[model samples]
Target: MMRRRTTLLASCTALALALGATACGGGGPVTAGGGDKALSGQTVTVAGVWSGSEQKNFQKVLEAFSEKTGAKTQFVSTGDNVSTVVGSKIEGGNAPDVVMVPQVGVLKQFAEKGWLKPLSKTTRQSVDANYANVWKTYGSVDGTLYGLYFKAAHKSTVWYSPDALAQAGVKPPTTYDQMLKAGHTVSDSGLAAFSVAGQDGWTLTDWFENIYLSQAGPEKYDALAAHRLKWTDVSVVRALTTLGKLFKDGQLIAGGQKEALNTDFPGSVEKVFGPEPEAGMVYEGDFVAGVAKDQFGRTIGQDANFFPFPAVDGGEAPVVSGGDAAVVLKDGKNQKAATRLLEYLATPEAAAVWAEAGGFLSPNKNLDLASYGDDVTRATAKSLVDAGDSVRFDMSDQAPAAFGGTKGAGEWKLLQDFLRDPSDPKATAAGLEAAAAKAYRG
Candidate 1:
């Protein structure tokens, strides 16, 4: 089953209009405290998986918080293993005051361990006003609110270069079969149809998630995510089989599977959008637009544009997404200051900071659409907010860390192996089931 709610777009529109008018009067950066500087002399520490540009952009949000409340903020990068990093910090009695958890399963683990502090009533109220209920549900554990989601990813977009597509004489496909046919047609022009990032196993998981959600529908998708349905179920086999159609086709993938397996995530985007393009299209989240622009110097709406991932087997298209949640640690010394930062994070003001910097999407419905840096970014953010509770979170993020988040083991490795040799979807399904069983049971 899926979470259902009255669509949030109407309320979001009204709030945006109100906020927009106030924002136009003053051109200063918006802050949650209205420049009260009430938090001077307090220091709050935060940890998360963000690094490089993402880390830089988040720092700007913290800068705004400091400006508003005069609280000093410190950020630590936890890399990809957020649970392990945070757990070690807690054990050493030096835990950060707050952490931006990357997975819902990890957030629940923290809350269940009594390591997370229940959010303040003020923070909860802010969340209720600005976000759809589903986001709050994901941030809650056992119906107790503990976290606030700040960043979201639209995982169903397929990005392409307009020049390349026009030269190939093919429009974006609306169905799976049409996508494949168009891929072949593009290949016939001596260009690879798709640039796949096989080196990053997480990308493989996203690819499978979109196909699974669309072809099998949300019930099976949720079952498979929770491990209530085995990965070896026919649904998984079917999704894997469908994915193999693209993975196994060497001509359709740029530089063949071998090259794809060697290319990292950003490299895959560069292959398509770079000056001398290696492929015509790439499949990833809306973040691809950021990479295309910042790393490759391409324009968003002009040189880079995306279509919703096509329907699979004539099924309705699905919206699969991922987000990071901000939570407070119960044992932290700076509880007051940390809670203050979280309250700010729940506001449209904090969300707008990263949104204007590009490569960011906020679930806060009260955030003005004009806050987005570009039209493409605005459209993608609206679709994500519009999907509301109908959106399915990234499947791997819902599974235990040992199974879903690890690099060389579990789903990541299994999918990478599958990409290396995609001839047997049944065998891949079996491997996935075994790994999932061990992880879930543990």
Candidate 2:
């Protein structure tokens, strides 16, 4: 859906300036009024774009914190655009004590700019012990801790209607060759094989990244994102060539790119399961489940199923997921309390609450699939934990914020074009390499 949330610094900076330096209200951290206790009746303002379901989930956790620590919790909900509100607040220097964000890249961006507070050594140890190594890296920048990773959603999977597949006599492809073969089989049967939305470059970009992971491996993908690696490298060329093969071979749905440009996310979702189907498979994150239910009128577990993004020969199999991080503003008080909140949020209990609310995979290693009331949520959560290797957060989130969507979009477009004509793989690879160089320099 291309919904990007905001950063803590941006949310609070604007509010701070609007308050005109009012003695840094929100209790200015817990006072040692009693002389020994570290925390005492502190009022903390927390800003986030959470509302409706997410807000209710957060409220429960805040209420518990307030009761136990005597901290007054006030929420400054920032409607729809989290980044805009956060950016404005950061400019004003009136940020909240804690702000919850969804993307780890934004957390790192703020950290690099000196907007985030360093997490304590104890917090790092706690994180290392409980969360996966992938998340540990996300919270650290230049060897210092700046943020905490929380909920995540795996994207390297294809969602399909099992009923539709059975009806068309198409089996789920276990490998790349199988996927192509299945694509042809489904197409021959008069059903679209794969439905990809290239008009929104983000959608197509994911397909390329996932393919790169399958062809090159995670380490190389990391190097590419860091600009320490060249895009013209054989692996990069091979990945694009593979993508071009998919587009030209009719493996992708007819007019998928043009259709995607005009397709509503929900309506596109309907095409996967609705009676009038344009495609039989969709490659998107777990968030599509909500839209699927709302638009397709088909229950997630009963009508739809998902499989890991297929693997390639000799390729390292790793699952990739993405989620946000919460950063404490440098200007904010309650540093220690804020640290406590971050730590608490990483706990299993907090994860459970988030799962119940947001329907995303929690970073906590102890997330209980049994607690998930819905079968689809449980299955999705199970797939995340069962993944052989954890590759949560895509290349976009892991890449430098400035170079992410801007340059990545161009790569997607070129890949889409190349996907339609596999004859000139070298030229396509060169085009991507040039774009990568420009992004890295910028």
Candidate 3:
């Protein structure tokens, strides 16, 4: 699923001041193509899943591009089903010039259909200079570079209120069992241990992914992602059962199961950081920090902090990451302008534009740590890069969209069902396998 967030104007204004730019606008223009207005008459259209405040921040990046190259840029939100929307546009010959694809599976699908343009040599060079080889590998199809991963997420971090944890007299956990114990302790102090975002099925998939990756290891994770191993495999059952250890406890969840099932992602975060918090912690990506700071006026490192998603059964914690890749369309009218946008996105300057805005992370090794608005975000990005080859992409995003990305269906819906009644891991596994078999066959 595509994560969507709405940031406050105050947050945007603060970021602008920090970067010496206008609110939700770019900094001073830097000339591109050896001229200030080289692409003066051109317009470029870009599409992605971002909307509201997220879209506004991305517009800042585009604004910087416009100032440099003198190209007008438009951003179209692809809504939730990005693949379907972009596919329809392509069929109707109204495809955008550029797309920020969130799913690697979708990127591969577009490449296979010959709808995507191979990135320019200049863009590839920028990627090589700024990113790690693993990022490039994900952007490539059949050994040809096709996308640049501009926005990255560290999905293994768990955000919590330090005061709440301290009230419970517990420290951040280092293992799965310890985390559960901490939850129980926090619950005893009258706050729900976790604000489960059951309404958003993607969050549940992330929970399962972290546990599965750490407990079963990367080989099984890769096999399941490719459907080489069935979802009914024992490894999946073990992971589901492990997750049930936490979800099975009603008191451990904020607002209980019913309310949690109705709560969206942002609501889940609010339960922990709001004026009168209902929960002590939330599990998701590093973006939670952005929501906490932007929406609740919480200080990231002090008021809100995170620990590595604790290791499972004494194993090393696995980093399950996700990113949005910028890909140009072959059918685009302004090919040169689109390629230049891709090149700009690959630069540290572009990454820094969003980094200072909060709730954003980049895989660009060249980006300065100071560019992040807070120490937590900088540490999160550092861990993501420090993990190097050990990091695994989000497993669901690696699967076909029908099975992984769709709402109210496939892995997403099945996980929601499991959240409602976590008693039957075997049954959930069976259902997932059935769905995967169908999606893979298609």
Instruction: List TM-scores for all candidates, in order.
Output: 0.93, 0.79, 0.92
Superposed on all Cα atoms, model 2 deviates from the true structure by an RMSD in Å of 9.3
lDDT of each residue in 90-147, candidate 3, tens digit only: 8899989999999988998999999999988767766665667889888999999999
Which residue ranges in model 3 land beyond 4 Å of their true spot?
1-35
Ranking by lDDT: 1, 3, 2
Alpha-carbon shift of residue 333 in model 3 (angstroms): 1.4
Clashes (backbone N, CA, C under 3 Å), per candidate, total 0, 22, 0
**The best candidate in terms of TM-score:** 1
Per-residue lDDT over 1-442 for candidate 2, one digit per residue giving the tens place of the 0 to 100 score: 1111122222223323222222222211211112222346667777776665556767766765554455667778876345567778878877777777655556666676677887655456556555667677777889877777666777877888886678778788778778878877777777778776655555666777888887888788788766688878898878877776676665467455456555544566777877787777888888677657655667877787777778876575557777767677777766666765665565454565556654467665555565565887777777776662456467766654444444235565565566445578788778877776775565
**Predicted structure with the largest lDDT when compared to the true one:** 1
With candidate 1 superimposed using the best TM-score fit, by how many Å does residue 356's alpha carbon deviate from the native? 0.9
lDDT of 1 by residue, 1-442 (tens): 1121122333333323322212221233354434667679999999999998899999999998887778899999999999999999999999999999989888988998999999887677778777888898888888999989999999999999888888889999999889899989888886899999989989999999999999999999999998999998998999999999899898899998899889999999989998789899999999999899998999999999999999998777989989999999988879998988888787777888999888899988767788898899999999999998888889999889999889988999999999899999999999999999999888
The better-scoring model by TM-score among 1 and 3 is 1
Which residue pairs in candidate 3 have backbone atoms (N, alpha carbon, C) closer than 3 angstroms, thus clashing?
none
Would you give me the overall lDDT of model 2? 0.65
Relative to the true structure, candidate 1 has a C-alpha RMSD (angstroms) of: 4.3
